[model samples]
Target: MSEQYPPPPGWSPPTRPPATQPYAAAPAAHPQQRPRQQPPAAAHKPGAIPLRPLTLGDMYDAAFKIIRFNPRATVGSAVLVAAIAMAIPVLATAALGAALDLSLATELTSGSGGESVTTSVDGADIAGIVGVFGSLALGSVLQGIGLILVGGMIAHVVAAASIGQKLSLGQAWAATRGKRWRLIGLTFLLGLTTAVLLVLYALSWVVVVMTTSGWQVPVVYGLISVPLFAAFFVWFWVRVYYLPVPALMLEPIGVFGALGRAFHLTRTAFWRTFGIALLTFVVAQIAGSMLSLPISFVSQAVLLGGVPGEAGVFVLVMGQAIASVVTAAFVAPFTTSVATLQYVDLRMRAEAFDVVLMQRAGLTTSGGNPRP
Candidate 1:
């Protein structure tokens, strides 16, 4: 989300009783005398950046932090984020194409102002284009609605499965029920801002190509900026990728505060975050290649081949659609889950969250909410 706003303000842990509780309650002769204690709960959760080697228990602690705090809410946020991430561009492109096609079809059916056959052909061509655009757009809209429903369902089911919670879809939505609109709006704004930055970054390269001189352009000017841009892109990405989502899901921070918190967490641990992000990218790339890229390439080949017109377009569109949607479904939810996990890891490190985890394991109460 471009991680705008001031640097992360100084943060401090809240003052609370020590994590460890006495093994047993005893009649004390003096009110001032304190009981001996066991090890602190924080020991179970990881502490501070350059995180200590994570054990299986540490990972579970991280996951359970979310589970304990708001079992259904945690799962619901992840699913919603995943679906929207997949649906946005797909819907935009499809809508544009569908609208263009439907408008063109309407014009063509109107007889081209009663002109000759060639004029009618033009009108018909326009109509076909509009129809294609409209259909694709409508397809995207339907896909979005489907994502919202399925994503919500996944959240509830996963929460119920992973945690000892009797969470239903209704409960999951209720966790963030009224606040969904705010989360959605904030997320969209952040996403749009990031996208605009990316577009500008690409356009900067385009500008370099169009305006610069020829002889040494490839090596001297244009290429020099490529490495710099790459560095900036990586830097920006690690710092901000999860900030907005973290803020929306985990805390009540404002947009600026969320961005600041994200970057703040990255400090002293840039390489770690970079590693996670790069790993995510590599995994996504591999999955996309297997699921969509080969199918898309084959579809292009078939579309360009000398075949009956309608059959070629239909085969290409339907085949590619199947490939793309499969990829979307798998990639979106998987990455969203992992990224959300990363956020928990960060919180654990900062907040000594292990203590909370130990407590949740034994909890059976009014809320059973892990102490946030």
Candidate 2:
């Protein structure tokens, strides 16, 4: 073996390569070869209302979702309150009508042209008409108050739900207790405002009729004023239609203050607010009609299907009552939920309430996830 020279520093001795064939280029991938796809993202938690600014779809979804989340507090309470409130007025009105009819029948039979009979009958008719009007007004007021209370309860439940909390009927009611009176006041104030506007509208028509030259003039004025008044009504309603019960419930505000706040909030988004309110009302009405119409038809059929006397009347009344209760149970909660959610959405957009909600929910720490 030949003596090897000393290896250089940081150098290594080369070894003989194994006896093998020359390397060949690797095969290329086919053009049709598809890459593997990544898996889809996980779904969000169910029944949780998002705290971010909402879209119309989000509003619709949240409305029904809140009802689903707490049916006992929302739908059940609505059913019970609405049924009682409506039944009282209906029964009273029916009794009054029956009594009035009996009295009129007796008066008519007593004498055809006697002055005493005519005077007594006229007085009775006037009293009955007044009583009927009073009953109707009272019923409307009671229903409005009941609706306000239900709205408050739903607002409480939705607030709890937005933060992953489950609210019971008692808890929701308790949350509303402090604001119940304010809510009632606000409802009354709204009703009063509406009534005043209606009165003014009627007076305008009366004025036109009284001041005009002839019937044609009054008719022409009415034709012109009708569209104008309708437009005004729509505009006014849109501006003040979304006063959320939460504004009164959570804050220290009175009816006027709440109305001012609602007006201000909706000032910037009038059309959106109007559209949402109109859509909610239309949808709720349609749904209620669809559900109740069948019951009404069935009741009418039963009444006209050879059934007569007190039994037929009883069936008709009970059927109508049942239909009303069922419709209220489903429809009231949904409409209230839409209103509450619309308020929340407006607040989120105007006040950045999502930040407050996030903090309340403890979702602002350590990169915690907040549903959008």
Candidate 3:
């Protein structure tokens, strides 16, 4: 048969087909597979500040932005409170000056036309001095109360603004109704503490001077005490008391609770808080001075040169009161905003408060999860 096949010209042996490779099934789909977690979304800013840990620039920018965000809640309320507080002082000053005929001006005569020069406080009655000091103390207390109340109102504004809500002046004031006295008491306590400490420091120096014979010990004590006490005061001011106003206003805590909250918030963040507050204060001072100094100088010159007696005193006092109101209008809101934002920032850094704020602003899922 093979010889017969070879005789066919075109006949050739056929090879078996190549073996078929086996088909590999895909690995069974993962059972109960874990879903990949999406990354956290970007910080949401529905208000003046971004809901995140804020930098110094962010705080300052937000503070200024707040002033423009709701003028009625900020500057208008500030001006109203300041005006009322200053009225009492202006009246007291005018009454006392008129009664005592007190003036701090000197008369000079250089020409030969029988000109005379007088340099003395002729009407420096003891009662007048007491009245003047008392008046000043009263004014300080009143101003402190006013400032605290205004700060409280502004805190409301800030809180609302953080959630992109604007408050009217009346609404802001209403928020402070239950908290006014607490804020005022806190301010008074802080001021009294500072005064007591200062008195003690002065007394220490006095004792050193009175008890010791040589100047060396007192000098050395002063050199040591001055810097040390100054540092202590600064620390107390920056790290302890500076934040209470915001805390008291924002949270449902009491006075001491606010104080403790402030202390806690400032922990591990003293330098940042201090630097920002100090810089803000310096800026405020410079701005206030720029706005008020020229008017003061003009009034003083008028008192000395042209205006006379109680009329001059009235002019000066009224001018000063007006200047205070104007300055407070611009300065109070900004300072309060900074303080509030600083509180927010510290809480965010420590407790993820940005998430809470975002949630409050309705930028989160109802399941308490942040929205992507």
TM agreement with the true structure for every prediction: 0.58, 0.72, 0.79
Q: Per-residue lDDT tens digits of candidate 2, residues 167-258?
A: 89899888886678888877777777889999999998888877877789888887898899998888778666456456676667877778
User: To one decimal, what is the Cα RMSD in angstroms of model 3 from the true structure?
Assistant: 10.9
lDDT of 3 by residue, 314-334 (tens): 776677777787788878888
User: Where does the lowest 10-residue lDDT sum fall in candidate 2?
Assistant: 101-110
Q: Where is model 3 poorest over a 10-residue stretch in terms of lDDT?
A: 102-111
* Model 2 CA lDDT for position 72: 95
- Which residue ranges in model 2 land beyond 4 Å of their true spot? 1-47, 86-144, 365-372
Pick by TM-score: 1 or 3, better one:
3
lDDT of 2 at 158: 77
Q: What is the alpha-carbon lDDT of model 3 when measured against the actual structure?
A: 0.82
TM-score of 1: 0.58
Better of 2 and 3 by TM-score: 3
Superposed Cα deviation of residue 317, candidate 3 (Å):
1.3
